[model samples]
Target chain A: MNSITSNVFGPAKSINVARVLLCLEEVGAEYELVHMDLFQAKEQKSPEHLARNPFGLVPALQDGDLVLFEARAIAKYVLRKYKTEQADLLREGDPEEAAMVDVWTEVEAHQYHQALRLIMLECFLNPTLRGLPTNQAVVDEAVEKTKKVLEIYEARLSEHRYLAGDFFSFADLNHFASTFYIVDATPYGSLLDSYPRVKAWWEDLMSRPSFKKISANMTTK
Target chain B: MNSITSNVFGPAKSINVARVLLCLEEVGAEYELVHMDLFQAKEQKSPEHLARNPFGLVPALQDGDLVLFEARAIAKYVLRKYKTEQADLLREGDPEEAAMVDVWTEVEAHQYHQALRLIMLECFLNPTLRGLPTNQAVVDEAVEKTKKVLEIYEARLSEHRYLAGDFFSFADLNHFASTFYIVDATPYGSLLDSYPRVKAWWEDLMSRPSFKKISANMTTK
Candidate 1:
């Protein structure tokens, strides 16, 4: 067990940090959480943190001598290294099913997250960070863009139980953290209610014990 | 072999399509090309195309009963299904190395591509697609962002031969198509001249036979 002690660095409130934490929880893997003060101290920009991730981003994982960054990539490393028969995060060894997982995961990364983050940045984080009011125009435009992305999700969920066809994989997990912020931590939570199937899918993902645990640990600033 | 016949749908001229095509060539995999007219006809918006990818995005791939979209996902599928002993595109068996590969891959997807695509859209694609003049302001902003990204790449490349540390994996392959468009198809091509390490890395990747083959097949609209 000592051989597998991994340290994850980032503030618990960070959406990206929540992403990896959820993966760790799902895999039932034990890791040391080194919370960096991203907002107050700006520790993420420090030399120590930058050495772990050149970009100075959050949720970098250090497993023994192998240091890794990118929340999704760290999640992949966690899933691959820690073998759990009950955990189906990566759906390891299943080529076609896994490819489908990759498809939706990429969709969430490239399409959904980009639009949703804009909303979170403008409507939620901006007000908190800058001590300024939320920008309604920016948030509205983001909401409109996200609605279009979710319409596709609604269509897909209308047929399948999850993003990658009935099975719960990283595809759903990839969207878990940010969507949590959008629906729970931000003003745009109601936007999801309009898309029934998408709403149901979100509800289902939120119900997972793994996500529940991580959500509980999130420190609201 | 006919049972495994795969078809890729998108205009040969598209950067996304070029990504999947490059992966296929690298894996020495045989696949059918199904060109969807993105311009003039706007065939990608048709229902037939939407069934393949609900987002109505190009570079959707169909392999027998299984259909997949998202260029990176399709590329992953190609690497897995039609693997070559001569090349390890995914670095499949090495967990640490593979995780490193994924780190760089994510960086390209999340950081580099977004900024570079803005430049591609404003400086190159906009003029051709909409008969509009180049938007210098947008292009300049994107270029500045891209320069920051490439500075990190230049530093990384100064240490390692490739993005994911020395070996040319999917991490490198993932950036091949878009970087080509930036350096060749856009005016910002000369931007690489300042980053000698990045320029050398680009030249090295371009010399790969796989990339050379795909470059020849690309239809410049």
Candidate 2:
């Protein structure tokens, strides 16, 4: 395990990849980004990359002998291995507080991320990446679902400063990469304004220097 | 922290709920089941229920003073709090092995579970719960996606006894509940048999006494 500088192989624009990068940045860990563009170059399906990640996903991390896929898993690995100042992302000592962090982390990924991904595909990716017209019906449905999830976030954020509690954790960090697109590049930026707490939460996330560095050129424009 | 017995609120038929029950059973943890049917009874939307989970979802957990939702989160809490012989489900001793478990756990949930959910909705829930006709189109797309994920599982299982490694872990456990429905109730039972390794892996999970106890009456019949 001499090679501590982990190699993160993923395209820069990928939200999941950006999440891994943000995690490393937050921990001040040294990492080299290996940009493998899955769509344009079809390099993800290459045999070498496939060897790294059987699913052929953009995010495959190599830390010495350990090669891992799934961006969140990689992030967790970083937090576990590196004892940086910000590495107490999961409340290492308290089980209940840690479980709360894990709870909201899953909620963000499973519910909020999926809904926002749908909206992004319809409103941003399809029209921009595939050169296809935006499907208003799909966007409308996604917006409805996103709003339902956001209302819950509003309630949670209104009480606590962050999703997990008074402290920021990976649960809060997980929201930034995807929701940033919704706030930055999509037609629904104003929706965040509807939930003031949620809006403030996003602003707080964007204010982080780690996220700012990772998302510097991440806008669709 | 004093009270160890947890109360899990969710319908008996829910896959996520069953997942939590299976984790509890695996650890031999004591829990009281409070059935809150989100669909038929609509108890999930009740003000009291919403207080537990603002997302208004079934599968809220009450353990002492802590209220947690998201079925996986509850399962993890049970694993963490209960130090039974089977509770080292995350490879607690090793960081590298633990990260592998987390990676595959996400794969099963995000990739395999989503596809299986869509297929179940089209082939089982829509027809059985809503009394609507099965949509072959949705099921077809979902089956295709599921097969792709299963291919990855087959490759992984060919090398190791479980998703994480030669030993069983939560990564393997996560697949049981949703996939059980697909193999038991849907028309796609034979699809699992297409991959011998995948079939054997599922057979091993199904044979577990913990899973068997929880899913005893959980059938479409």
lDDT of 2 by residue, B13-112 (tens): 8988998888888888789999876777799999999899887887989988899999888888887777556567877558889899899888887788
The C-alpha RMSD in Å for every predicted model, in order, reads 2.0, 1.8
Candidate 1 A-chain TM-score: 0.94
Question: What's the distance in Å from true for residue A221, model 2?
Answer: 3.7
Q: Rate the local accuracy (lDDT) of all candidates.
A: 0.85, 0.86
Best TM-score goes to which candidate?
2
Where does model 2 exceed 4 Å of error? Answer: none
Query: How many pairs of residues collide in model 2?
Result: 0
Off by over 4 Å in 1: A1-4, A219-221, B1-3, B219-221
For model 2, what is the alpha-carbon lDDT of residue A209?
92
User: Tens-digit lDDT track for model 2 on A57-97?
Assistant: 87999988889999888888887776455568877567888
Classify candidate 1 by CAPRI docking class.
high
Report the Cα lDDT for candidate 1. Answer: 0.85
